[model samples]
Target: MSEVTDLVEMLEKTGIPMSNELIEALLRTEPSDFTDFPLESFWHDFPVPFLVTDSGVTKTISAPHMIVTMLHHLELDEGLHVLLMGSKGGYLATLIDIICGHGGKVTIIEPHDEIAEHTSNVLERRKQCGLIRVLGKEALEDPAWDRDVDRVLFTGSIREIPDFVELLIEEGGFILGPFGGRIQQRLMKKEWQGGAWLETDLGGVVFGPMDIRESERGFPDPLFIADEFEDALILISSVLGENSEEVYRLERLVESLRELPPGLPEITSSFTEEEIIEHPVIELLMTEAEWLNELWPTFVDILGFDLEGIVPDLEEPLFGKRHADFTP
Candidate 1:
């Protein structure tokens, strides 16, 4: 308690817009209650990764700063329903559940299987968060999210508003998340008004590259990018066996990526983002970026696209919503 209290004070001193109610509510539980991450991690103002692999850090509890920024912007209070995407290892959900209280509901949709399992274990172990429900992509068949909610938070980054907002939310309330490209983005708040959503850029933020696999750069390395280019084409060709100049052109792009030092002595060039489409599941992605919205739904299930890869550039999240089973 002392350590977390000190951490909150530090955040306040740094001008985090934490209200007395939130601070007091948060103190009732600890980050440890939700995650087995190191205790020292809970005392800092940095993201604490709970899920990691050779693919890189797939998920993390938002740093204290980001957490407070989101909480303040969310305008959370008792009895407001909140829909959250991604578990953040259950830490953020726990806080939201506390703030919303017994009368309120906090529904979390965690796309990753392991992450969702971890969060469910955490919630089950910590019985205090009685108002929260964590649902994985499979359980999503029940359409629980279709209900009205006061707010929606995408823990990972997104490029556009989720399509479901039209039917899931009335012409009122807010949707908050970081929106933009995989490399850069800003927190955006969309307020429903006059049967339309008015957008506001809250501030710049570095969000989850949300790619299932990544290197130092959230995007795959140059060589891997080439491999994926080849993979995407193959997947498309597998589905639509017809060949064309566009396929040939894309094949050449893949070859260019594969162009390494001709000899063991070796040479290579760094591929720019433009040359390398960033999302990890390129093979699963539509070969033609322009046709994604149209092709995504019919093809994604066959590709087995999952929640872990959220596919930042994907326009329609519905196609990207298949329950995830990752490569070992």
Candidate 2:
């Protein structure tokens, strides 16, 4: 089989879906051209957000599932102008370059000087430097920056959509980013109308916080945490049979929140699993599950049993302290 077919098969076997167009785009681009590792060794069917800098900061090459989802939402067309806000690894930028071809222009803004230089050097070595621009500074600092872009994508998470982002968009353009703080986040889509921006929730995602100068502090907004908690509850309920009163209550709450508006109040930080468990709703559900003895595999699965230390710690609070004080 061809290498592209192998990649497609691998993604399918691992339950990571991608559109045929994206699969073909991946086939056309060479992963080795962008990364330090060999493509054959590094390409795998998993969400591998690897560290790209010595500072321990990482970038999501975005699993095939996320790439496909983001592309679908962006509605990208050939020759459209694109601006990428981060460039820790040039994997996603490289893919965008291929899809845009010779007609489209891609400008990358990387705040970290070392990573920006490294990415530019690699692309140059591969002879793919033309039709692309890499700036090693804050995105807004570049005087030559184009304000009218057809699409914008931020590879990191932000607490709120910045006002400047709208200024960067041409009328009717859109920006996609992971919105929220550490521990909890959601993929958000924002489109520019003539005078206002329209936003949509694109579901949950895990991402590192945006590399801004200001530090994010404190706990996430209660409403945001509640929304994410409800999503987890719904997922767990789906596997455990969704007919329980607890599930119904959680669903109703989620629905009510959805009716409020597109954006939730801005949150500064995120809740630990311990803090999440302390919520009255979560406590009530756990107690109910224990009463029926249905909290073993289901709860363990949602929290991730094989995730090493994370699951064990989560188990202690919900199942352990509440029951026999089991320690694993």
How many angstroms is residue 110 displaced in model 1 relative to the true structure, after the best TM-score fit?
0.8
TM-score against truth, every candidate: 0.63, 0.60
Error of 2 at 54 (Å): 3.3
Best by lDDT: 1
Top TM-score: which candidate number? 1
Give the local distance difference test score of model 1.
Answer: 0.65
Q: After superposition, how far is residue 242 of candidate 2 from its true place, in Å?
A: 24
* Candidate 1 worst ten-residue window by lDDT: 319-328
lDDT of 1 by residue, 180-281 (tens): 654457899998878788988898898864432222233334464454445456555554554855457667656655663322211113544333343333
User: Which ranges of candidate 2 are over 4 A from the true structure?
Assistant: 1-3, 10-21, 38-42, 47-52, 56-60, 127-130, 143-146, 213-328
Candidate 2 residues 52-169, lDDT tens each? Answer: 5677755545655566567667776678788888874677777777777678777887777877787787667654423777885465665665576999888878777666566678
